[model samples]
Target: MSDPIVPPILPREFGVYFALLEVSALVQHGVEGQLRRDGGLSFVQFQILAILGEDPSSPRSMTDLADRLVHSRSGLTYQVDRLEQAGLVARVPSEQDERGVNVTLTPTGAAVLARVLPGHADEVREVIVDALDGADRDELTRLLRQVARHLRSRPPRSARRAPTRSAEA
Candidate 1:
């Protein structure tokens, strides 16, 4: 057999970039099954529920959800459509804007969220969180926040500090 191919040199920073990509992919893959089995949810669908769960009482506009999710409006709509069909969520007219629609978690949605969150937490701990000590995890979060802020991928207007939730939550 021919000798193994050697890759070209890349900037040192590329290591962090590639690591982030690999870890994200692995973590998502690790949790995908649990989310599906426990909540009958796709990752994006779970994300929608989780976001709404952050403030279940308040409604979030479709546009806001799409932006925050970094997903296309149509894709988000499809996911929302699925959730709505399952009776996990509802779309109501926005009181502030006659034409705008807001998404809210139904009681079923909240119950599903509560049901799945504990297992999700455990899955995350197994796949990623437990790999690091507490300080290291904090550092990782800080670095990611810095990168996110630099990229402006997260818009402040659509971002709110989520309260810390217990595992039971």
Candidate 2:
């Protein structure tokens, strides 16, 4: 077998990457735990509700929701199904596209979000905001925004077309 190829990563760059990974994982876990205990919602479910709650009257297409949330189509479908069962969200057939489904935040979902948002904000402040000073927060935001822009400029793996056999050869 051919040896595995490894990309060159500078020591400093690797340190930054490791720090980001650890911070993200820890923060996400904390937020997830808080959401579960306080709101009885998973992180993804809370994200879905927050997205829909942004414009309660505007129904977002499933594709839009999946893209915005960075969730797989199938995963979003399952979560939406659960939320629907709980009467927290509703799926409506899109008038613009017969094949498309639009999801909207239900009244119950909005109420839950309203109840959960204060605690969510507090958790965010505790885990992230309060940990950084103004300048540090601004610098971090700038750096992360640059990274996000670069990453998002490319098509996601699932969305990219695979190379044909002829092209590979």
Identify the leading candidate in terms of TM-score. Answer: 2
How high is each candidate's TM-score?
Answer: 0.83, 0.88
Residue-level lDDT of model 1, residues 1-169, one tens digit each, is 9997666756576797788999989999989989999999999999999999999999999988987787778799999999999999999999999999999999999999999999999999899888999999999999999987787754543354457999998
lDDT values of the candidates? 0.91, 0.91
Point out where model 2 deviates above 4 Å. 1-7, 156-158, 161-169
Positional deviation of residue 73's Cα in model 2 after best superposition, in angstroms: 0.8
What candidate 1 gets wrong by more than 4 Å, as runs, is 1-9, 153-169
Query: Which lDDT value does model 1 have at 22?
Result: 97
lDDT for model 1: 0.91
- lDDT, candidate 1, residue 162? 53
